[model samples]
Target: MTPRWYEEGEEPDYRFTLANERTFLAWLRTALALLAGAVALAQLVPAFSVAGVRTGLAVLLAVTGTVLAAFSYRRWAQVQRAMRHGRPLPMTWLPFVVGVVAALAGVAVVVVVLLHTR
Candidate 1:
């Protein structure tokens, strides 16, 4: 069944709709990559000097990916709705949140590698 919001807004331009879909797909791809990274870290990477650090990082990635994947659809719908209503696109915190988390994860990985190499 179509979502009620889908019917509420006037039909947006085809190009805009397609673009929104593409954006959504891109988010999905990122989510998939994160999930893959999580699995790789969990299974392929050696244990860190600090016990549970690797597992914690892996869990963090998995959770981030899951949340991003789940929210991408909602974001897409929100954009679509805004376009249909001729309103300004809504601002989102997702990118900022993702960036901070990713950066932290990268830093954690670097720290782990450095500590492991010692």
Candidate 2:
């Protein structure tokens, strides 16, 4: 089946297109923030009992953010292509994984702070 955009030779709304671009940039910015936070935590924290583990996790988060940033454009392109070609857009798993990791990280941070404060 032809895509709604191309089936009848309909042009995409420019306003919506611009909005999509803005949203993609926002995602990239969020990824950057996550990367910075991870790097700072890993590097600034002193060596302690769980320091190594926290540092390792922080590195992982930074890498994940980097990957997400790199892939953001690619994913946006895929969605655009799908819209233009009337094909299903590729599914994304990064967001779900990121969410889960963020939740776990929050729990870890709480545990660390509680222990440190006592």
The candidate scoring highest on TM-score is: 1
Clashes of 2: 0
lDDT of 2 by residue, 67-118 (tens): 8899888777656666655556679887887788788788887877787777
Residue runs of model 1 more than 4 Å from their true location after superposition: none
* Local distance difference test, candidate 1: 0.92
Q: lDDT of each model, Cα atoms only?
A: 0.92, 0.74
Model 1: weakest 10-residue lDDT segment is: 1-10
Off by over 4 Å in 2: 1-10, 86-90
TM-scores for all predictions: 0.93, 0.76
Residue 2, candidate 2: how far off, in angstroms? Answer: 22
Instruction: Write down the RMSD of candidate 1 (Cα, Å).
Output: 1.2
Give all candidate RMSDs, comma-separated: 1.2, 4.9
lDDT at position 31, candidate 2: 91
